[model samples]
Target: MGSNLYDKVHIRHLKKLGDLVPDVHKAHQGFAEAVMKDGVLSVKEKELIAVAVAHSTECPFCIDSHTKGAKKAGASLEELAEAVYVTASIEAGGAFAHSANMHNALDEAADDALYRRSSMEHMKKLRQHAPEPFDAMMRFFQTATAEGKLSVKLKELIAVAVAHTTECPYCIDIHSKAARKAGASDAELAEAILVTAYLRSGGAWAHMALMIQAYGEE
Candidate 1:
């Protein structure tokens, strides 16, 4: 194999891991299968969630795998595009939401707390500071979360999954509640969380091939 860091062939090394760590590798495979199995959410929905999380986690292998999985499960290109936009909006929204901390630091706010719920109140200040871009971002976010090819419930579920990968508490709190309001059950929410967990770990699992290759170099 060539020295390319992210060649498709590199992923073939994942199979060798079974010989080196049979028990843990087997358990990881089992967990991945169990998480992606149909349950409260359909296979198509789970795959869509995986697609969104693969983007959030920036895992090329997971992105390629889940994007194909999503298509095979019957997701249309438009639906997959919407899932990617959902990931984009959430990733951007995390930074936008954190601007409150910037505002706090500027004011030398005495709370000394990093992420108070009340900090969100300062979001308006961003609007006041840069009305054009701030408003544009808000419009994009609204359109991203709004009903389209994907239902709001599914979009919100995707948002919750992406939020976990982003580790954005504000997005998690907001979207979890929005998901419930859109008629997602606790079971569904838990499944979405599990999908996020699997994909996050799956990223590392997929990258194991890179580490193995590096170790083999003379």
Candidate 2:
């Protein structure tokens, strides 16, 4: 009704529908609480994962909410910043990783194959031409995923979650190995992925409140 349509106040509209769908509303709330509680990963760790996945989802509501949650859960500003860059690296990495597809497409004798590990060799050309930016990205990714306040193991785990969300096989392959190398057990990686699943689903669930407001207005 004003200059902008999506203000924080719009979230309250979900309560107006509570009586109509009490069970569904309550289930969503319960699931959110259950997933966010400390498990194998602490709440602080979970919130950081949420922040990373939130960036991949590009859900402003999620980014805002989880950044606040991460801070409240005792994630420092540096930790939060590092988490965001991890997300960025994976997101951009998705694009770079998929360049293998283009390589396959360009080769006259490339066969019908759409993907192969050998296709990644095409990336070497970037080192020849776009050396500066390519090297800079590599530096940033290394720095971001390196151990600081957050361990390399944790950051690699977060990268795995984002790789799943992005559906990038290259990133998954690279980070999974990196995660394991950094001492992330299979169980810890599994738990991080479950947290990712929660945040991905939760992004859609959180936006339903906005959908309700929009529909009511129409």
Candidate 3:
């Protein structure tokens, strides 16, 4: 193995995993194929979602693999870039949206509940507290999500996928509604969520290589 932690060669260890556990490996492969094959969303669309979710998961192997898959599926550079920006916006937006919790924590009268859907209304207080940064984040989010190279529907779908990977309920709720409004079908939304689910698992699966390396060293 290379001295670097995540060399491309490390992925080869996946074969060893398959050799060790053929049934589970084969099942995983089947599930991946079922989720990724064309249905409500095209293979290209699924790849784009995979790319965004891979970034959200911060999986080096997934980022590398799904990017290539996206390209092979005829995703343009512009489309892929837009998908990445969607991931960036959702990640940043999750933090921005969660500032409501901070406001609640600072309030002496606030209830003990850590996460109230109603507390999301407190997000408005951020603009009053820091107008400039708040406006900037909003502007960046608007730019990232607005239709350009990718359609609004596609961008919203990507946002939904990344939100699932980020495990942000606020993002998932917001983007899922946005996705529906943008004309995404329930089936399409379901596929996007599945893509996120697959990639998140694949991240851990990929990191098994690191575990194998550690065990070998010991």
Which one is best on lDDT? Answer: 1
In order, the Cα lDDT scores of the candidates are 0.93, 0.85, 0.91
Residue pairs with backbone overlap in model 2:
none
Ranking by TM-score: 1, 3, 2
With candidate 3 superimposed using the best TM-score fit, by how many Å does residue 154's alpha carbon deviate from the native? 0.8
What is the TM-score (0 to 1) of candidate 1?
0.97
| Backbone clashes, each candidate | 0, 0, 0
List per-candidate RMSD values in Å: 1.0, 1.8, 1.3
Per-residue CA lDDT of candidate 3, range 1-218, in tens? 45899888777778897789999989999989999999999999999999999988899999999999999999999999999999999999999889888999899999998778898898888899799999999999999999998999999999999988888888888999999999999999999999988998899999998888877773
**Where is model 2 poorest over a 10-residue stretch in terms of lDDT?**
1-10
lDDT of candidate 2 over 109-205, digit per residue (tens): 8877666667778866667778899899789888889888888989999999999989898899889999999998887888888888888888887
Residues 1-218, candidate 1: write the lDDT tens digits.
47579898888889999999999999999999999999999999999999999998999999999999999999999999999999999999999888888888888544889788888898778888799999899999999989999999999999999999999988898899999999999999999999999999999999999999888877
Best by TM-score: 1
TM-score against truth, every candidate = 0.97, 0.91, 0.96
CA displacement after TM-score superposition, residue 12 of candidate 3 (Å): 1.2
Q: C-alpha displacement of 74 in model 2, angstroms?
A: 1.0
**Candidate 1 clashing pairs, residues 3+ apart or interchain:** none
